[model samples]
Target: MSVNNVRNIYCVGWNYRLHAQELGNTVPESPIIFTKPTHALVEMTGQEIPFPADQGSLHYEAELVLVIGKAYRPGIRVDELVDRMALGLDMTLRDKQNEVKKQGRPWLSCKGFLRSALITKTLPFPGIDNLGKTEFVLQKNNQEVQRGNASLMVFAPQTLVDYIGSRYGLDAGDLIFTGTPVGVGPVNHGDHLALYWGEKQLGECTVQLG
Candidate 1:
């Protein structure tokens, strides 16, 4: 019963150059998407992630959540499209994403929060265009900081669904957190975040403060 309408939420900032030098930004060439509102997707563990006390840091970007099942745009390629894969949680706010890039604004307060993109439950791959060499991971309370694969994504994942459907148009429960690697930081208050792809742990949460 999960995997319902999640509308747009394609995020892929600094695909991973140590998260673009921790935020300084560089290696781009393509996908650098951003967006997160569909009610900020709350509770999606088995269900229940209501943590938000005010916000100061709260970071953790262990993503691999591409779940689109239809609807396309932007010169559709990669053998058309159709998805159903899993794992989510792209929560961030590192000081409101460093004051929205110092000032250039727009990132909706470090990625529209509330429950901040937390999903899973739609697992039916053979689609998602294979996701070029998948193999991701990121743990906290357990150890293992961050691991990478997806061929060190520098804008892959079908080029971020064809450059974000050629400018926002990917429908059918849109979602695509395909980023994160090079150990990101922050995640206090109870911290227990966990995620995996190759070994298939897919979900885990506990960070409470907001």
Candidate 2:
């Protein structure tokens, strides 16, 4: 599927236990939901992500992305909602995020920016039964930088889809970022980022600091 088809970009924060603890945050009882505009979407193949000129502290968050196939109403089953899967990068402005957190403000500027949502091509989703065995990895400069399994998620993908759907009905072209794992860090110019699902390499791209 093309990135241009995505209508909504929903993201969950601190869904991984180690990721929460790494940033000194307590595990949430419910998913922490945020959103990025559709324009933020960027394909991973041979793409260059320009660093946000306004923010000095930028970070990379590797995540499992779910593509909604059927329109979801309240109380929809997770198995029926997801059509495809992919690996993605939830690029963030850490300094801006922290500032907003201190003032109790929303994270629009911190989380939603141009080319902030980078994704690999969609793969066939084997259904919710395969979730437990699913794993994703992120490589930076040819070395493993971050990795996580579905088992480590505080809020599973099914739970998130159900919960989020209850509050906001999901449409067919919506993409949900299941959240990042522990090894998230800053990115610089000329850095290479590669993402994988299980043993299958998904996508690779380079960073272009502006």
Candidate 3:
């Protein structure tokens, strides 16, 4: 299947209250939405991600990813939509992001860069809402770094689905990066990161400093 033309990459920012506190932001009244160009998508298990050299720091965000299987418009009930996913990384340019945020400009510069986003295999399974339990963890160099469960989310997956749907029409091939939990930090050159769901390996990749 041609993975190009990724319709949209919907991202939730600071959905975890602790993550917000770390970044010095309060919990949002609604889901914070952002977009990454389709070109940014890369398979973490097979590709090398270029670390931003000019930026002061490149951060790793471990998130639960939802891959949409069908088209959806705004206002659709979260229970009615089906999402396939596991967990993936949402890499970011922290210095660049802070600069842009200070300028009150859109986060495009911080979020949209070639190979800036990564995903594991698109495992098709039950929709996210149907999953009774959701857990996520990230390890770097075999060291546990970040841990979070779906229960910590300020808004559930259903709420996220419905909120974004009301504003943008979600279609097949689109992916959603739910907000990350605390423990986000920088990744150094040659750092190996592994993502896991329970006992299964979701994916892994190495970082090359640019």
lDDT of each: 0.71, 0.89, 0.80
TM-score of each predicted structure versus truth: 0.32, 0.96, 0.92
Clashing pairs in 1: none
89 Cα displacement, candidate 1 (Å): 1.8
Alpha-carbon RMSD to native, per candidate: 15.2, 1.2, 1.9
lDDT of 3 at 94: 91
Residue 137 lDDT in candidate 2: 92
- How many backbone overlaps does candidate 3 show? 3
lDDT of 1 by residue, 35-151 (tens): 888778754464335556576677777776777777886677644565567767678878877877878889877778767777655566554445555676777889988777666
Better candidate by TM-score, 2 or 3: 2
For candidate 1, the 10 contiguous residues with the lowest summed lDDT are 42-51
Scored against the true structure, residue 84 in model 2 reaches a CA lDDT of 89
Q: Give candidate 2's total backbone clashes.
A: 0
Error of 3 at 18 (Å): 0.7
Q: After superposing candidate 1, which stretches have Cα over 4 Å from the reference?
A: 1-9, 12-32, 35-56, 60-64, 67-80, 96-98, 105-122, 125-163, 168-175, 178-186, 194-201, 205-210
Evaluated with lDDT, which candidate comes out highest?
2
User: What's model 3's TM-score?
Assistant: 0.92
Per-residue lDDT tens digits of candidate 2, residues 156-180? 8878988888787688899999999
